[model samples]
Target: MAATHDVTNQVPDLVGHDVAHDPALLESLHRHGAGWAEAELRELGVHAGSAKAQERGRLANENPPNLHTHDRVGHRIDEVEFHPSWHELMEVAVSRGLHAAPWRDERPGAHLARASKLHVWGQVEAGHTCPISMTYAAVPALRHSPELAATYESLLASTRYDPGLGVPAGKSGLIAGMSMTEKQGGSDVRANTTEATPTDSGGHVLVGHKWFTSAPMSDMFLTLAQAPGGLSCFLVPRVLPDGNRNPIRLQRLKNKLGNRSNASAEIEYDGALGWLVGDEGRGVRTIIEMVNNTRLDCVIGAASGMRAGAVRAVHHARHRAAFGSALVDQPLMRNVLADLVVESDAATTIAMRLAAAADRVDDPQEQALRRLGLAVTKYWVCKRGPAHAAEAVECLGGNGYVEDSGMPRVYREAPLLGIWEGSGNVAALDVLRAMAKQPDSVEALFTEIAPVEGADSRLDRAVSEVKKELADFTDAEYRARRVVERMALVLQGAGLVRHGHEAVADAFCASRLEGDGGLAFGTLPVGTDTESIIERARARF
Candidate 1:
C-alpha cells in the first residue's frame, strides 16, 4: 500500500435519532407533566431528527423565500414563494397541532404538551416555528374580542395548514402574523404613526408603514396603529371579503442573518381595511397577551437550539479520536461538553416548568408564576443561546464552522430569539415592571421555588441575594439585567435540584449560584463529575 489513511475514528451519524425519546428530553417532559404524550412525541421526534428532516432543513435554508410584487400582466399581487421543503415542514407542524394544540384541546397538560412538541420540532428546523408560534400565540389575543375570536378561532385551531391567500372565510385553516414595530417606534408602539381612520362601515382603515412584518403569507395580522382614540390593535386581513387583495403592500423582505426559510418583510398599508380587536388606546394591553405566548416560544426555541448543539457536540466527541484517545475521554473536552449539557438542561427545565404553569390556567398561583416566570426565563435563556452555540461549534473544531455542518446556521438563528418577542433589555425591564406592578408575581415565583429551599446551600444563598436585590428599587431599571439573571439562576437551581440528576444540579449550583464559573462555557469547577454529566446528556442521543 502506497499510503494508508485511517478513518476509523470518524464520528458516527447523529441523524435518524428520536429527539423526543432522548433521555434528557424525556426526563424534562416527565418532570413537567408532559410524559403522557410520550408515544406520539417520540414518533414526531424520530421524523423531526431523521436524516430526511435534516436534508429538508438544509434545502429550506439554502433556498430562501422569494417575494413576488406583481403579476405577469403587471397587476399588483404581493406574494412570497418558498421552497417546497418549507411547505413540507409546515404541513408536518400543522397536522400535528403544533400550532394551536393547547387551545384546541384544553386538557390538563395541553400547553406543556404543545411546548414539548415545539421543542422537538424546532431542533429539526427553527425557521418554520415562527409562523407556528405566531399562530399559536394569536389565539389568546384574538379572544380579547369575542367577535374577532369567533371569526378566527376555529380556523386557527384547525390542524390543516393552508398556504393559499384569499378571503379568510374561504379558507379552511389560517395563519396569523404581527406587525408592531414602525420606523420611528421600534418597541414603543405609542410612538407609532400608523393612522387608523374609522370607516363608514364601523371598520377602521389603516394607512402607514410597518418596518417589520413577519410571515407575510399569513391570512391576517395583529398590528398596532394610531387610531383617533389612540394606539389601538387591529385585525388586518390580507384579502378583503370581496376576495381582492387588501391595501397591504409588501415593500421587501429583510436580508436576515438566519431564519431564511421564513419571510420577514417591510410593508405599507394604504387604506387597509381592519377591525378593532380591543379597546382603542388599549393596544399594548391587548397585544401583550400575544407577546407573552411568543416569548415563551422564544424560550422553547432557544432551549431547543441548545439541546441540538449539545447533542451534536457530545455525539461527535464520543467517537472522534485525537491524540490516541476519543475527544470525549479527554478531561478538558469532557468539562466543556458537560457544561454545555448543564446549560441545556437548565434552560429546558425552566421552559418546561413555565409551560406547565401556562397549562394550569385555572390556578391563581400558576397564573402569577406565568406572568413573572416568562420574562425571567426568556431573558436568561435567549441571552445565553448565542454563547452556547459558539462553544458547541468550538467543540467540533474546524468542521463545525462550515454551513454544511449545520452549526453555523444554528449560531445565526440564536440571536433572532433574543431579538424577537422581546430583546434582553426589554425582557429585563418587563421583569422589573411585573415586580413593581404585580407584587404577587414575585411571591408566586418564591412559592414555585420554595420546594428546593434547603436542597443546596449555594442555592439558598443565591435566593437570599436575589431577595435582597429586590428590596432596593433605586435604579432598578439599570440593575434589571443582574436582577433577572439572578432570578433565572435561582429558578434553574431549584428546578435542577428537584428534577435533574444530583451531579448535574450540583455542578449548576456550584458554577452558576456559587460564582465558581468563569465568563464562558466549559468553566465548571475541576472537581465536578464531568464524565457522568456528559454521559447522561449524550446518552439521550
Candidate 2:
C-alpha cells in the first residue's frame, strides 16, 4: 500500500474551520474588519470622504458630546459628527441626538458628563452597540409593524445612511429608542410605580418618572409601567405615527459613567399614549427578547474594549524600548503580550458566534443553547478581558493610568460590561435555567472540541468533568456552573458550525473543545459566589 498515510488526509484543514468560535475565542468577524468600518461609516454617511475626515470627526476624543441641555430631553436628542467631511452634519445630528438643538460647542456638552460613566458609554464605540440596543428595545416596538422592523434593520445595517432612505428618511429625520429605568427599582420590576392607564379618549395616559432612560431623545420607546395586569410594555412615540405629539416626555439627562457620546436621560411622561406590546401580562417576557439582544451588545463592547486596549498596549510594548531592549524582549512582557493577543483573538471569535446565534437560532432547544452560549460567553469574556487589559496597562507602567494613553478608557469600560446587561451571576443563573430546559442540548454541546493539537487532551478532561456535572441535577448551583463551563465546549462545537467543518450540528462530536490555558472567557463558578468561593477554598486552599 506504499505505507501512504498522506499528511493532507491525516492533518485537518486549519483555515477550513474557524477555531475562533471556541468559547474563549471571540468571533473573528470584528478582528477581520476595520476595512469595513469606513465603508460602514460612509454607508451611513457617518464619514463622507477622506481618511483624515474620519480620524478628525471624533469630537468626544477632544470636545466630548453632551445630552443635558434640552428642555424636552426625551423625544429626540440632537446628533453630532466630528469627522470633518460630515462635521457640520455630525454637529447637527449630535446636537439633535443630545437634545441640544441649534449646534453648540462640544465643551459644555461633555462637561455635564465628562468624567461620569455616561460620557464614556454615550458615544458609539462599535457600530453594533447603539443599533442593537435601539433595534431590540425601541424599533421592534416602534411601528410593531413589519414595515417598521425592516425599516429599523435597514437603518442600523449601515451607520452612514441617508436619513432620507427607509425610516431614516422620516420627514423629521430622527432616530431613537425606549429606555426603562426608575430610581427605586432594580430587579424588582414589579415595583415600577410608573402608571399607564386608559383614558376616555381611547388612549392610555402615562404618568410617572423614569430614572434612567437610555437614548432619551428616541422617537419611540417600548415603555414599561404598572398597568392593569401587572407590569406592561407599551410602545410610546415621540411623534405618533401621524407625527403628532405622542405625549412622550424627558425629565433630564443621566450623565452616566462611560459611553459619553450617547445620552442617558431621566424622563417623566403624562398621557403618553402607547399600544400594548404582546399581551398585557407578558411585558417582562416580551421585552426580554429585546433586552437579551442588548445584553449581547454589552458583551461586544466589553470585548472590543479589551481588543483595543490589547492592541495599543502590545503595539507600545513592541515598539517602545526600555531597559536595554524593547518591552517585547523581556520574558514577562513577551508572555503578557502573547497572552493579550491570544485572548483578544479568541474573544472576538466567540462573540461573533454568539451574535450569529442570537440573530439566527429558532429551535426551542437551539434557542436555549443560544441563550446559554451568550450568557456564559459574555460573562467570561467581560470578566477576563478587564483583568487582561488592566494587566496590560500595568505593563505600560504609569502611562496607562493617564487618560491620553487610552488604556484607561478601555480599562474603565471593562467594569460596565459585567455590571450592565446582567451580572456574571445573573448570566450563570440563565445558563443553568437553559441547561435544565434543554438537557439534550447540553449533552450535545460538550461533544465537540479541537485546539492547538495537544490542547484536545485538556478539553477531554474538562468535558468529562462537565458531563459528570450535567448528569446530575442534584445541586442547582453546581448545575449553573456546569451550564456556563460548557460554554467552552459549545464554543468548540459552534466553531465547527462556523467552519462548515460539520454538516449536522453535532458532527464534530469526536473532538473536544480546545483553548489556550488561563481561563480567559469560560470559567464557571459553582453555585452562588459566596458559597462557591468557600467550597473551592476548602477544596484547594
Per-residue lDDT of 218 in model 2: 50
Best by lDDT: 1
> Residue-wise lDDT of candidate 2 within 333-399, one digit each (tens)?
6555544544554555455555544333344544555666677776777767668668768867786
Candidate 1, 357-405: lDDT as tens digits: 8888889899999999999999999999999999999999998998877
Candidate RMSDs in order: 1.4, 14.4
Regions more than 4 Å wrong, model 2? 1-58, 61-128, 136-169, 172-174, 200-202, 241-246, 358-366, 447-455, 478-541
Question: What value of lDDT does candidate 1 attain over all alpha carbons?
Answer: 0.90
Q: Estimate each model's TM-score.
A: 0.98, 0.68
Give Cα-based local distance difference scores for all models.
0.90, 0.50
User: Weakest 10 consecutive residues, lDDT, candidate 2?
Assistant: 532-541
Q: Given candidate 1, what's the lDDT at residue 436?
A: 83
Best TM-score among the predictions, by candidate number: 1
Candidate 2 clashes: the total is: 68
